[model samples]
Target chain A: MTVTTPRGFRAAGVAAGLKSSGKPDVALVVNDGPSDVAAAVFTTNRCKANPVLWSEQVMADRSARAVVLNSGGANCYTGPAGFQTTHASAELVAQQLGFGAIDVVVCSTGLIGETLDRDALNAGIEAAAAKLSADGGVSAAEAIMTTDTHSKQVVREGRGYTIGGMAKGAGMLAPALATMLVVVTTDAAIDAETADRALRTATRETFDRLDSDGCMSTNDTVLLMCSGASGETPDADEFTSLLTEACHDLAQQLLRDAEGSEHDIEIQVVNAATEDDALVVGRAIARSNLFKTAVYGKDPNWGRILAAVGTTDAVFEPSALDVAFNGVWICRGGEPGEPRDTVDLSGREVTVTVDLKAGRQSATIWTNDLTHAYVHENSAYST
Target chain B: MTVTTPRGFRAAGVAAGLKSSGKPDVALVVNDGPSDVAAAVFTTNRCKANPVLWSEQVMADRSARAVVLNSGGANCYTGPAGFQTTHASAELVAQQLGFGAIDVVVCSTGLIGETLDRDALNAGIEAAAAKLSADGGVSAAEAIMTTDTHSKQVVREGRGYTIGGMAKGAGMLAPALATMLVVVTTDAAIDAETADRALRTATRETFDRLDSDGCMSTNDTVLLMCSGASGETPDADEFTSLLTEACHDLAQQLLRDAEGSEHDIEIQVVNAATEDDALVVGRAIARSNLFKTAVYGKDPNWGRILAAVGTTDAVFEPSALDVAFNGVWICRGGEPGEPRDTVDLSGREVTVTVDLKAGRQSATIWTNDLTHAYVHENSAYST
Candidate 1:
C-alpha cells in the first residue's frame, strides 16, 4: 500500500531540521529500472515555484531516475537564490546516486515566498540517498506531509504487475490541479507516451475533480514512473484502468482528509448538454460558500443549490431542472417537491444530484462543506 | 436621507404577515411625475425570481409609475404560482394608486422555492399605498431588508435636482448584481435613455464591483425612476457623476454591513494592460477565500494574494508583480520586501494594492473578509 510496493523502486525519508517541529521533511525516491519511463504534470498556475521550474526541465525528456522533495519552504517567489537551492539539492542527490543532475526531479511544499536552508537541504538529500531502501515508502510519504493529518498510500494489483502511489494535500485544492504532490510507481512495461496518457487520463477524472477550496496553488506536481521489473507488459488499456483506480482511491483519501472539513459532498450533474457543461455546473456548486455552509448546517437548503446552478452558463431550462439531496428529491421541475425534512444529512457523506435535462452527458465533482473550522484553520494557517 | 427625499415621490411600509416576525415586510413607492421615464437592471443569473420577471416587462416601455417590494419570500423557483403572486401584488398597487397594472414594478426577497400568501401580499400593498407619504422612505427602506442589520439610504443634491435611493442586502453579493433590492428616485428632468446609461455606468463602478461573498442571487433588482419634479435638465455627465457617487456611498454601506463581516477589504489592481484586465485581477483577488480568510486573521499573508493573482489571465510578468497590505509593500518583485509585522490590519478597513506593471489601467473591487461569524451566520440562516 505504498509507492515502494511496486518492484524496482527504493525510497527514503529524513528529518533535515528544515521543519521547526523536528519532523521528517526530506524524501527521496529512485527507480532501479530495466526500462526507465517517466511522465509528470505540474501546476498550470502562471506563478511557478522554484522547484517546479527546475523539475520541469528534468521532465522534458519524459525520463527521470530519482525525485527529491522537501516540506519546509515552498521556495516560491524567493528569486534566483531559491532556484539555486533547488538546483543544488538536485545536484547533491544526483552526485550521491552516481546519476546525472538532469535526470533528478525536485518538489517543495510549505509556506510560499520563503527560502530554504541550503546546507540542511543538501545534507538531507545526501542522507536520503544513502538510506534509500525498497521498504522506505512510508517514511517518504510521511516526509512530504505539510498539514496532512495522515499519510495516504494505495497499491493495486494487475494481471502480472503492480501499481502503487502516495499523495499529500490538505487544502488549496481546486480544478486543473491542487496544492498536492503525488508520486506513483508501476512495474508494468509501459512506454513513455503511454505512461503520460494514462497518468493524464486518470488524474483528469480523479484529482482534477476534487475542489476542496477554490484556491489553486503555485506548487503542484504529479509524477509517474515505470520500472518494468515485473517483466509483464500489460495491455495499455488494463494498465490505465488500474492506474485510474489507484488515483481515485488516493483522491478520496485526500478529500476525506481535507483541512477542517466535516462533510464530503459528491455533486453529480447528470443529463447535461455536454460533459463540459456538467462539469461547469458541478464546479460552480462546489465553489459556492452559501451551499457549502448550508450543508455544514445540515439544513438541506435546496434553494442554495438551484441558485448556484443558475450562476453557470450550462445549457438547461430554469423551469426544467431537478435537484435531490441524498436521493431525496427536494426540488422537482425547479419548484418544491418532496419535503426538505425528509432528506437526512446527519452523516459525513452527502450526495447532491442535479438533473440538467439538457442532454445525455454527465459529470461528478467532490468537495467539502464550509464550516467554522474551515474558516478557523485557514485564517490562522500561515500566521 | 431616503428615496422620498426627492420631490414628486411618496413611499410607505407596512407589516404584511408574510414574515412570521411581523416586521415591516411590504413597501410601496409612487412617482407623481411630470415624466414617467424609468430604467432598471435585474440579476444576471438566468434563474430570475418572479418579481424580477414581472418588473423586467414593466421596464420594457422605459416608463413606470410605482414599485412594490416585499421581504418575506423570494418567490423564486416557486413556478407559475409565484408569478401570479407577483402579478397580483403589482395589480393591487396599481389599483390603489389609480394606474395601469403594467406600469407597476414588483420585487421580493427572502427564502426561495416557497409560495407566498397572495391575499396577505395584496392587503399589504393596499396598506402601503394608503400610508404613502413624502417622509415614509425610511419605512420603505426598512421593509426591503432581509438579514441586513440596518437600513441603507443615500441622498445626493445636484446643481438643481436631487437623487435619493435605498438598498437592502446582507449576503449573496457578487458581480452583475447581488441579492439586493434597490430603489433610486431622481427629480432630474432626463429621458429614459440617459437614465439607463447613467444607471449602468454608476452600478458598473459601484455595486457591480462590490463582491461580498462571490455568490450571485436570483432576486437582485435595481430600479431608477425619474419624476422630473425639479424640472432641471442637468448636464448628462454631471448627473452620471452624482449618480455614481450615490451608488458608491450605498455600495460602501452594503460592504460595511455585509453578513458577519469583520473587515472590509478594497482590492486595487494598478498598471494593468486594460481596465478589464484590472477588473479581472481585482475580482479574482476579491473572490479568493484564502485571501479573505488571511485578512480576517489579520495575518498580512501576501503570498496568498499573489497566488490568487496567478489564477487570472491578466497580462503581467509574475516576477514583476508587487503586493501591499494597508500601506506597506510586503511583496515587491515577487519576493518579500517590507516586514509583514510592520503592516497594521486592526482596523475594519483594509486596502490591498497590486502593481501589475503592464499598463496604466486600474480597477478597484470591494469585498469582506471571511470570518467565523460568516460561517456561523450562513450555516444556520436558512434553518
Candidate 2:
C-alpha cells in the first residue's frame, strides 16, 4: 500500500538523465479532488533549500494540486539561479496539469550546493505527468530515494476513509526533523484547518521522535493532502489517530533502513517531571556516540548512558536514576545492579529504558548504533 | 615539562597492582609552598565522579597541599562506597604528606561504574610519596592517562616565574571540559582570588573550546596550585596570558591525539552578534558528524558545513553566509564560489572559517574528524 492507496490520487515516476546512474529520479503526485486541502511542515534549519523556499510559499494558501520531487540534486545554496530552477519546475508542472503555479509544491534531495540540469528535470516532469496513474505510487516512492536501501510506504484505514504515506531518509536524522521527504494522502472529507492540526500532531509523535543520527538536514519536508472523494467525514480524533499510526509505521521503516545501521535502539525515558523533560533525556541518550557505539559492541555499558543523561537538565537525581537493557536492570539507583553479562544485545533490536524518578511523564526516541559500516558509508562518498 | 617543573613542587608515579597490565596507575603532586593557594574547575556534568565530588569540596576553601590522581577506574556511579574510596585516597595522601585530609585533592579516570581497588590504590599512594622527586613530572603525567597515547606537558615562563602543567585525555573531549585531568603548578607569589580568576579564564579559552567528540566526562578536573616560592608577583594579566598559552598548547596536543582521529579541524565563526553566538555556531559545526565525516573523506563538502551552520540561532542571514576550507573560499554569499578542487585537505590540519556577517564578535572550536577507526575503537571494546 502506498500514497495512491487513497482515492482520487494519481502518481508517476520517471527518469530523464538527471542522475548519472540513469535511474528514476523524478516523481509527481496529483490530487484530483472534490475539495483540495493541504498542510505541510518543513525543516527548522535556517539554511532552506531553493525548493523548500518555493514550496513554503505554495503552501501558504493551505491548498495544493500536486507535488513534484526529484533526487540526484538538492539545488540548495545555489543562489538566485537555484531559485529560478525551482520556479520553472513548478511552472512546468502547473502548465501541464492545468493548474496555477502557486498551487504546486516541489521537493529535492541529494547533493547540495549544486545545480540541476533544467532540460533533464523538465523532460522527467513531462513524462511523469503523462504516466500518472492510481497504481504509480510505488514508483513515486522509489524515485525520491537518495541513499535509502528500500522504498517505505504505509496505509491505514480510518472510520470510513483511508490514509496512506511514503517517506525516504537514510541519514542525517535528528529532532525537529531529519533529512527526510514525506508525503501523506487521505481520502476523507476534512477541512484545511483539521488537516493541518492532524498533520502536526501525527508528526510530533512519530517522525519527530526518530533520531537516527545527531545531524539535522536542510531540506526536510512533510506534506499532507486531502481529497474528499471518499465522501466520508470521519471524526477528527479518529482521523488523527490513523494518520499518526501510518506515520509511525513509515518512521519505523525509515529507521530500519537507515544507512549502514545494524542495530535499531529505542531509548525510553520515563518518570520525568514533564513530557519535555522526558524527551530531552531520551534525545540526549539517543545522540550519544559513546552509547551508540557501546550498543554496536553489544556491551551493556550503563556508564555511557548515565554520562549522556547527566549532560541534560531534565529533572532527575543522579543517585536515584535507574537503567535497564532488554528488561534487565543493569543499573539501579545509579550504581551497578544486576550483572551486565545477563543482558544480551546480539539481536538487531535493542531497548534502553531509563527511569528519571521525577514524575509520571515519559517519551521514547529511536536511534541506530554507530557501526564501522556507518562511518565507511558516510566517509566513502558524498550524499 | 609538567607540574613538577615548577619550583617547590614534588611529583611521583607508581603502580601497585591497580592495573592488570602492571602499568603505573597512581600519581601524586605535592605543593610545598610559602603560600598553599589553589583554584580548580571540575566537570559541569551533574553526574560527577566520586573524586570530582570530593575535590570540589577541597577547592571550596581555595587552598590545597597536594593532588593525588589515579587511572584504571573512574570510580563513578559506584554509590557511597565510591565516595569512601575517594575520601580514603585523599586521607592517605594527606597522612603521608603530614597535612589535613581536606587539603588534598583526588582525581580518577578510566572505566566508569566501577570501584577502584582501595588497597592497591593506597599502596600506590604510599610508594608515590616515598619516591616523590622534582623530575617525576614525566612519569606523573604518564600515570594519569587512560586512552592517551602519550603524556601532554607544557611549561611557560612569565615575567619572573614559571608555570608547569600536565594534562591527560584522549577521547570524550567537549566543552566545559573533557574526560581530562590537568594540574597546573606555579612558583609565583599569587593570591587565591587571582588563581581562581586566571584558572577560569585560561580554561575557558582553551579546554572549554575543544569539542573532540561532543561528549563531556564526569571526572574532568583542572587544578591550579601556587607555591609563592619564586617571590615574584607578576601582573595578573601576564600570569593569565602565560597560563592560557600553556593550556592552549596542551589542548592542541589532546586534539592531535584524539582517539582514532585522522584530521584535526579548527572551526572559526566570525562576525556574530555576540561572542556567545559565535561560540554556539562554532560548536554546532564542530559537533556535526556529517561535516566531520566529510573532512575525514577529504571532500571539501561545503554543503554539510552550511547545513550545520543553519542549525544555530546565531544572528546571520543564510543567504549571506560565507564558508572556507583551509584558505579556499569554496562557498561565498551562500553560493559556489572558488572551485572546490582547488582546496587541499590531505594535511592533518583543516580550518573551516564561517563568516556569519552578523556583527564583530568571533569564536573558535576544535574537533576531530569521524573516521572508521573512531567507530572501530569505540565499538570493538568497552572503555
Candidate 3:
C-alpha cells in the first residue's frame, strides 16, 4: 500500500491501450472520507497541460474527493478539444465514485501536444472503477510512469496517524518542483487550511530542491488529500514533519531511478547571508555543466566550482570562500589548500560543500553529473 | 596577418615552458601608435581571473601600449600570489617596450587555480619582444587557444581604415559577453571616447549574442586598440558598422570551431514586446537541454521548444506562438501544423524561428546541440 496505506482511501489501475507497450496507463484514487480536505501544487510553467487546467479549478476550493491520472499523452497545446477530454475523464471518475464532478482532480503525462485517446481513457475509467480496492496502491503507482524505470512509494507513521505517497518522474527534473506527478494521502484529522499550508511547506523544503536537470515541465503536479478516518487530531506541526519525510523519501527514489544517471551529487551551501542566498548559490553551482562534468570525471577541479560561484550575486567575499569535496578541503580562503590528488571520488555519491562565511544560513540541492549515458538517453528520448 | 593586418601594430608568439606540450604559450601584441587609444570589456562574472583584474586597471586610462597573454594557466582563485604574477607579467612587457608598467594589459587562459611559471613567463616575454613583427598575428592567435581546434582571425576594411582581430574560446561560452579572449586593432584616426563607443556598440550586437553552452567564464575579455596611422577620421557610424562586421566574422569562426559540437543552432525570436523580451525568450529556448538534445538526435521535436518558451516571463500568448524548423512550419498557433518528418536536419547548421506575435522587436542567439562528444570532452577536461 502506498496512497492507500492510510484508512478511508481506495485506488485502482488498469490498462487503457494508451501506451504503445500495452502497459497500465490509467489510475484513480478516491478519498472514502469522514471529511474531505485537499491541496495541490502545479508547474509554474505557463504552457500547462489540459489536465492541469482542469484540476487547477477543482483544487481551488481545497476540497477534492477523487483524482484521475493518465500517462500516455500530455494533452497540451491540443486546443479546446484536449481540455474537453480532461473534463470528461474527471466526470467519469466522479460518477463512478458517487462524488460531485467539481470534486474530481485530473493529471496527465507523456508527449506534449498530442491528443489523448478519449475512448481508451473512457474504457479505462470504467474498468479501474470496477476493480477499486484498498490494496491497489502499488498498481496506482505503476500507472503514472513514462521514462521512469520503477515506481516510487513511501510511508511515514506519525504519533497516531500515517502519511503515505507515490511519485513518478525521470528526465525533465529541476527546481520549483521535480518534473513529476505525486499524490499523498493521510488519515490524520486536519482542516483544508492546515492541509494547504502543510503541503506547501513540505514540498518547498524537499521536492523543490532536487535539480536533476535544469528543465521545467508543462505537466508537473503534486496533490495532498486528507480522509480524517483515524479520528486522531495530531498537531499541525507534527503532521507537517511526517508529510515532509514522506515527500523526501519519494524524491530520493525518483533521483535514484533517474534515467541514465551514474552519479548523484549533493551541493551543500552553508554560511550565507540568508536562506534565499544559499539556495540561489547552490542552484547556480548545481546547474554548471563544467562543474557537473568535472564531477563525472572524478576530477577535483575546485577552480570550476569557484568560477560557478562567482557568476551569482549572492553575498560573499571572493577571498573568503571555502570549498570541500567529501571530507577534504581542496580550497580554503579562495586559495589551494590541499593537493587535489588527495581527494577521492570513486563512488556513486559525491558531496560538494561550500562555506560562504557570510552568515548562518544553509541549503542543499541534489544534482547529477553530465555523462555519456545522460546525453544518449536524452538525445534519443522522443524517438 | 590577424591583429597585425592593420598598420602600427606588431605581434609575437613564443614557446614558453609553462605548457607541458612545449607549444607557444605566451603572446604579445604592441600598438606602436602615433596615438595610443584603447577601450576594453571584461567578464561580468564576479569571480574574475587575476589577469582580468590587472587589465581592467590598465585599460582604465585608455592608453595601453602593449598586451601580453599566456594560455597555460588561468591564474584564478589562487589568491594574492596570482595577482602578483599578473602584475609581474605586465611589468616585464612594459620594461621591454620602454613604457610605464601601467600602460600594459594582460590575459590568461587554460586550467584555473594553478600558479603561472614566473621564470618561464619572464624569459618568454624577452623572446617574444625580440621576434615581434608585423606578420606574427597567426602565431598570436594560435598561442591563445586552450581547447579550440583552430585559430580564428578576421579583417574588415572601411572606406579609409582597416580593422583586424583574433579571438579564442570554445566550451565555457555564453553572454553578457562570450567567455573568450579577443583582441582587435585598427589603423583609423579616432579618439579614446569614440573608440570606447564604437567597441561597445559593435560587441553588444555581435559577441554578446552567442551563448554556446550557457556557462559564463571568469576570465573573458575583449579589447580594441586604435592607432592614428591613417590620418583620416571616418564617420562614427561607418566605423561602428565595420567593427561590428569584423567581430561578427570572428565570432562565427569561434562557433564553427567550438569543442565537441556537431550542430550549430541559430534561434531567432521575432515579434516581441521589447528587444529585451525577445532576447530573454530566445535565450531561454537556446539554453534548454531538452531542446538541445532533441536537435542533437536530429529529431524535430517542437514540443520541447514550446516548453522552453513557457518557462520564460517574456510577452507571448500560449495560443499565439509559432515555431518553424529550417523552413518547415512545425507548430502554428501553439498547435501541430505540419508533419515533423518533413523537416530535415542532415547538415551542421540548423535554424529555429519563433514568432511571438506580440509586437515588432526581435533578437537572435547562436547555440550548440548537447552531444556525446561535448559530455566526454568536458568530463575529462581538467583531468
TM-scores of all predicted structures: 0.98, 0.98, 0.98
The lDDT leader among the candidates is 1
Clashing pairs in 3: none
Model 2 per-residue lDDT tens digits across residues B37-78: 999999999989999999999999999999999988889999
Which tens-of-lDDT digit does each residue in B26-109 have in candidate 1?
999999998899989889988888999899999999999999999988899899999998998888888888889999999998
Worst 10 residues of 1 chain A by lDDT: A170-179
Location of the lowest summed lDDT over 10 successive residues in candidate 2 chain A: A170-179
RMSD of each: 1.9, 1.8, 2.0
Candidate 3, residue B118: lDDT: 84
Q: TM-score for model 3?
A: 0.98
lDDT by residue for model 3 over B1-383, one digit each (tens)? 48999899999989988888898889999999998899998888888989998999998888889889988888888789989989998998998999988989898887787888888988999999999999999999888877777888999888778899999887433221235889999999899999999999888888888888777788888999888788778899999999999998887888877667778899999999999989998888878877887899998788888888998999899888899999798899898888888999889999999999999999998888988877777777667
Q: For residues A226-288, write the lDDT of model 3, one tens digit per residue.
A: 999999888999899889999988877887776667778889999999999999999888888
Residues A68-146 of candidate 2: C-alpha lDDT, one tens digit per residue: 9998888889999999999999999999999999999999987888888888999999999999999999999999887
Classified by CAPRI criteria, candidate 3 counts as medium
